[model samples]
Target: MALRAVVRSLSELCITVGVLIVLFVVYLLYWTGLRADSASDDEIARLHKQWAAGPVDGGAPGGGTPEETGGSPSRGQDTTGDGQAGGTAERGAAPGTARGTAPGGYRSGNSFAVMYIPRFGGGWSKPVLENTGKQTLRKGLGHYTRSAPLGAKGNFAVAGHRRTYGDPFKDFPRLRPGDPVVVTDGDTWYTYTIVARPYRTLPSDTGVLDAVPAPVDEAATPFDRPGRYLTLTTCDPEWGSSHRLIAWGRLDATQSASEGKPDALTR
Candidate 1:
């Protein structure tokens, strides 16, 4: 009888701990989701206030400068050579700009303002300035620390939770070939088109998302160059993140603020 009583008490304790963990998670989601929508001046202002107010190099800087990062054979060059869009990583372009490095345009403090995914049905999230940090990745928009600025000549990567914090990519798989993903700063919007689905690659598949992402099917080599690509990742289970699911896209069109951005594009 004593053993039975102890077992029941332990079970009750376990349940209590589980409940507390869930509550903590709920709070985390609330804070992160609040910022995932489209980037707005008001949003920026608030973030600036939270960040203690100062100009931040928009996008993520952990990935390094556009030219210094994401330029290896792993990224794969434009095998198609269509020329409509080669590749971009120009500095100062905006958050989530093209991966191909575009020299000479980069300036600091506000590269990307917003991110658009029609898969999410026009509702987008604002791009935030960040550096590679454990806290940043856990929140949303992990800076590459070693990559270029957003829209610079290299890749600037961001990460978010798959099940919590509104799970920004909850519907990301809905993106089809030629579907568009747009990122906008205050003045211009850079566009990307869905080219590939998330394929499992070794963590070494760095060049593609690196200086360039390497071909998933091929070995790492510069000549294996494919084209500029964007890899969107999230936890696979939908309910829990165990393995990662990645979605790929290619650069498409760019628009100025006057062009009328898509409806539901911003937060």
Candidate 2:
């Protein structure tokens, strides 16, 4: 009887494993559509040129014309600047060497340089840019809809997973005040300083990705929550995404070339 019971237990385990593998394959198939591999050389150069020219208001890279999606956090001015700070949540860590955040956050179709958190490790090297067509989840930093362009004005919000899907925000818990976060437009590298790591509710009913952050603790700063605030959001509890983890960083404006770990060819 004991042997029979043991055999049955092993059989059940095998079945469960098989089911998991099949589900995983399906997930990969769905996620495959999210990648951008067929970019044209001309398009790449154009995006690079835009980044070199500094922030532009006449539609971002591949922004089509201009969108008017309402996303003003405070001013109610349809903020969210024109840039790619997309989102798509994945649970498991991505396979292979991680790519550094590049073309950083372009306006879809338009390539933008992405500054990654090298200190944050492989999981954070490349941030998954999201699109506006789907439900926003912060799997990666989302680009601004229209109006507030990258390096221009408005809030440049971004999101990531803290414990799964490579867990970009794994070190988010350790990010101290004044940590550096650089964003390049190919030519100029914009800098951001870590400020705070706060939290909000699920789905973020409010305009969490606004032109600027909602007054947290009534802290005062230049430009009225001004300059650029790099908002990073992730799941809470670290096990399951029960709540959301939010953090804010201010743009330094003064940009320089990026020279750090994760050299070229790592991409």
Candidate 3:
């Protein structure tokens, strides 16, 4: 009789532990994602509101209009793949030209831009916030603070999660060369074109964020000269972080805030 009680107690304990583990998994994979999605949406909305209010200090006004539905961009206001605009684009002191905290400098943990990838779908938009801290990533994509400014002369690197936290980079591996990754700081729209397939490397490979990124694992980088570039990174394997997957791009175009939307975003 005593032996039977011992076996029953052990079984009950095992069941309890299993239930706890399942609940934790659900929280990480489902509940956390829901919360992160909501947070990201809120950040995007906040950025739009700030832009509508104009420049924060004496800086250039937040220029881009809120995301719109089907409508043709005004004639002569479209941007090409070579960072040129057709019409007279507002090339005033846009924040994309600033490298520090002036009128549009990025603040730690605060969002200053919105990123859109056509390949990610028409409705896909994510807030690009400063800093890749643990908590900041829970809200949306994080910008590597040390990288170059938006559309600036060096590497502009950003990081996002592969799974959970809304899985912003869940499709990181699907991106291909020539894909357009567009970003807007409300003042200027910068479009970058993917130059190579995703490169997989260990988490310690920090050279990938350099001004002229060095080779990874002796693998040659597509960039041959010093130019404005964009680097997106996420965890590999879809479910773990033992390795990072990187996507490299070069600045291809820019549009004014007054411009409705860049071609990469409109079509």
- Using all chains and alpha carbons, the TM-scores for the candidates as numbered come to 0.57, 0.52, 0.81
lDDT of 3 by residue, 1-267 (tens): 999999999999999999999999999999999999999998898778656654432333323432211111211122222232222232232323332323224556777789998887788889998789998899999999898878888899999998998989888888999999999988789999999989999999998998988856666576878999999999988998799999999999998878879999877
Winning model by lDDT: 3
> Residue 186 in candidate 1 has what lDDT?
46
Compute the lDDT of residue 135 as modeled in candidate 1.
41
Can you give the lDDT of residue 189 in candidate 3?
90
TM-score (C-alpha) between model 2 and the true structure: 0.52
Mind giving the per-residue lDDT tens digits that candidate 1 earns over 27-68? 767755564442344444443342321112321444554324
In model 2, the runs with Cα more than 4 Å from the true position are 1-111, 118-124, 127-141, 144-147, 200-202, 215-223, 256-267
State the local distance difference test value for candidate 2: 0.47
What do the candidate models score in CA lDDT, each in turn? 0.49, 0.47, 0.77
| TM-score: model 3 vs. ground truth | 0.81
Q: What value does the lDDT take at residue 151 in candidate 1?
A: 55
The segments of candidate 1 whose C-alpha lies over 4 angstroms from its true place after superposition are 1-15, 21-112, 154-156, 202-204, 219-229, 239-242, 262-267
Better of 1 and 3 by lDDT: 3
